[model samples]
Target chain A: MRTGTGAGMPQRGAVGAEERIRAAAVRLWSERGFHGVGIRELAEEAGLSSATLYHYMGTKEDLLADVMSRGLRRLVLAAERVTQQRAGAGPRMNALVQLHVLTHALRPRETRVVDGELRALSGDRRGGVMSLRDEYERYWRATIDEGRASGAFRVEAPGMARLALLEMCTGVARWYDPGGPMALSEVALGHAQLASRVLGAEELELVDEVDWCRGLVGEIWSGPGGG
Target chain B: MRTGTGAGMPQRGAVGAEERIRAAAVRLWSERGFHGVGIRELAEEAGLSSATLYHYMGTKEDLLADVMSRGLRRLVLAAERVTQQRAGAGPRMNALVQLHVLTHALRPRETRVVDGELRALSGDRRGGVMSLRDEYERYWRATIDEGRASGAFRVEAPGMARLALLEMCTGVARWYDPGGPMALSEVALGHAQLASRVLGAEELELVDEVDWCRGLVGEIWSGPGGG
Candidate 1:
């Protein structure tokens, strides 16, 4: 267990007011939507005055863009780490699934806001968020392409496979209940197998990768940067 | 080629003003969400006065509920028709996939509202929409269970597999483009194959089932109930 000393990482035990505001925004925006939630409500949810909320966050859209960018940046970082660590296409894709499943399942609110509220942004903000998202998706794209090229995946349309698998995994956030029957680990493993099936790859045991990605999720989503 | 003579089916060649209002609601709500859009904007979009919009829809929530129920009802009807027409679990699931993909592709806005705006409803209205949705999901559940029981599908968690496949298919509404390279039929066929793969079933030919489902989508989504 390494300490998070990154620039935006929160101190060991202190959760800043800005982090609280971000948490409130993610919760509200995900339950309703970006346009559906108001700053006053957001402030109340975060236990801050409107003026205080405004002091920490510029506008609602700015806060939304900030939230989206931060969430996507974490995903891109984790996906990049997974790619760098796992050389084989099979292992890389499996780790990506586990990481994505864990992220969506554990941080359902933040991931939902990131997935569902992209349309609320405009112009340059939209483009910036989209760029981060594109960066994240490129990892899956490249891994699938690599697998297909190596004859490890047998999908006819690599691009479609990527989109379907991504959506399949992302949907976990919509319906996953922490108190549900299956443990989060089983859900992650099931998705990995499904992704492998979609890509026509041989189903390899992904328990170790899932455990590793679980640690990665904790690392990236922890501290001050944690949502 | 048969006419939609069933009750609630719109007459041929005539788009009623109420239908226009429904279309406007679906379009606006899908873009901005149910709580984000106001009645004035909805009226403006539908080329109706505020009073006229009210005449067509009781309340904003009523309109949202209406949109959701209509969209989901169409799905339930199509799924039922598919089940009646296809007895084998493999063909039944494949046709369900194509019907779902086609519906989502052809009616993205209406489906988006239904998928995203359930929380915007209240009391019995929410319950009603959820029941319709649950009814539709039961078809997928039954088909998957049957497949697994008969050894036609291999999955540890059939429920999770059902959810994964549904999300994967429902996601077509989020990304399918008519002007894109693949024809709608190809998208449908591709998703059917993907579902088959996820179930670990032999990849049977789905061209006929896909074609049949294309017509089924047309029949269910046509007439007065069309979104």
Candidate 2:
């Protein structure tokens, strides 16, 4: 499930010291499961001391919830924009799928942590994380239900279709590679079409807003109060 | 992501010692992940000492490989059966979707280890594990390609469709719960229809062989030379 090699998945090279720690945390946490990663290794990966690591992020659980929250929050904002930017429900749904595929492909580690490690959070921490997740999923459910009501999409079980399409689109995080022949745009288009088909649409629509989505992801993920 | 609690997931209440070890491995490995699990806890769960654990399954890697291989082999056999059970490629693909969803639902731990820990294997072990996976996926690819050739499944990219459908069906493993309101039968049927839609089929066909698939899975996983 690990993507980058021993060099530790390069950063922007302009990230601040604290941001570097956050990035390293996401990378190491994804490459090695949370329990498999240690404080010293994390500090080493971040080029900082364990004490300084605590300065930037509280506990490991605090850092984990921070990562998960940031990823889900950005997704929610992106989902809100994509579902509203386009005029019709069908087009909004199409845009949502394309944007989701692109974001997941771009931030595989962050998305993977969000998808795979919710069980690790507990108590109020778990509640906060799950609430953000619920907020993110609400956009998807609302769009699907709107499409179904508008006669833009047909599905016997809208909830099932939502789960299926979300899982289908989120899978881009698992195998997407920029070095490979498959481009991020191609993945977005393909997953959008698949999502359409999954929802029982008679015809598929392609959305071309990759740059917009990329900018939005950057703004949301790195913006103030993101993590 | 954890399945059951305390009672250790309630196996048939009667199984051989080796089977008990296998069950324990799946539960622990799924909850804590492979690296997070240790032999002592595994042995304790199986009601045996570490010596007996090593006796039954050689090394930890051997046991990991055994667990992964058993899941994949059973899937491949079930894929073979389901793909050949019906005459047309459509029904075959439908059955494959249902069987996959059902199997993943019933045995999330096995499927999780198989999907998430492929990189944990190295050298000949990795090769052997991936070969079984390729064999399993070949049935999916062949069925999809056959459907495309026969004009039964409409798809722009058959490979993408195959990946999408497989991931969609397999997502059941991450979320399906026996105590939840969504019945296993409903999940099977819903995913079958969703698979048909993802492949761009105009009509959804129901597959009636769920029990047969369940039986075949038990037989294959329990059969000799399987694990």
Candidate 3:
């Protein structure tokens, strides 16, 4: 998963140049579309020369694909971990919603890039990113399917319900502000409850799940895995 | 509120040049953010010279603002017409969802610009567009409030519920395809039912309202009002 390291750059290998490059790419690409940015601009933003940029990454499209892949793959990992222990559909859905809302709230720029830039990639790159996204979405689909099977939830169109719920949670990225009046915990809990309503499931007390998901977001995003 | 009309362009004034310019702006701006596009490219896309582009519209920001205002204003008009005769909260909410889903599905490019470009404008222009958007959102807010007061809807937080529902409905623009398996009517009704679930209200048979709203979308978007 890591690339563009020289023998002399070992000290910075853990968390310096490549991280800066990823950060710069996410910021610029999110501000402007993929075609709207240039390699030199990315290099300057990352405080590297153009030659060094190419040394670290492939083409600009490659960089975009890398950013999207990393983000979606991180989501896949987090969703897997969150739902691994939860057996009941209601609690599973609640935990998933809280995790998603918190992720979108904390990592809005990355979420915007992943959501908005899928059409910008070429065929193979697009397919790869799309597959990762689909993989992530399956967690939601399976939760709904399990809920329907056990008669824990009642939805006319499970597919449409999943889509609606995903968009609703992902939208926290577009507008959530840390400095806003609503506490992050409140937002996560509110969305979890909303998810229950959307699924026509009984409301469970998800305060603990919300707090647990917050810790999980901190771990995944702060570690070398995602951020 | 058109700015680019001149004295000598009566024949093209009604529906030819201005419509082309609006269409081109929506397409380009939706593809690229406001800062990502250039005046030269916009003029080329509109099939007009740069000078003529200036004559037809103000600055680039002005054009963006105009496009947003037109799209949002059309929603305001349509929402008012749809909700005016309906007294119950369920019926009103159902109609609003259908209209919004249809508008976003049919005019995705315009919806993208309106939803995505609010940050690109300066103070006065941003304030104007924001006012139109807030005005449009008030319809949803009032409907939700009415539902809560009348005991027709049950929700923990009306504001959060409103935000979630709005995002869910607006998401139709991101992925809907007319040529896809789900007909437009199914998409609209599906969303209407989902909205009902979110509000904890009984599902209303909104098939008739969905059909009527489709006709309303045709009239508003196809006429000089929105398109």
**Per-residue lDDT tens digits of candidate 2, residues B12-101?**
322355677887888988887877778999999999889988887888889888888988988888888776667788888878888888
lDDT of 3 by residue, B134-191 (tens): 9999999999999999898988789888989999999988878888888888888899
Ranking by DockQ: 3, 1, 2
lDDT of 1 by residue, A1-227 (tens): 34434666653322467778888998888888887788999999988899988887888989899999999999999999998888988989989998999999988888989898888899999999999999999999999989889888888988888989999999998888899898998899889999999999845655556678878888898755633
Candidate 1 chain B, which ten residues in sequence have the lowest lDDT sum? B9-18
TM-score leader = 3
Pull out the clashing pairs in model 1. Answer: A10-A224, B9-B224, B10-B223, B10-B224
Clashing pairs in 3: B4-B56
DockQ of each: 0.66, 0.63, 0.67
Candidate 1 Cα errors over 4 Å, as ranges = A1-17, A43-56, B1-18, B43-56, B208-211
Tens-place lDDT digits, model 2, residues A80-139: 877667877778888888888888887788788889898888888889999999998898
Tens-digit per-residue lDDT, A72-138, candidate 3: 9889988999789777887888899999999999888888899988878889999999999999999
Quality of candidate 1 docking, DockQ: 0.66
Candidate 2, pairs of clashing residues: none
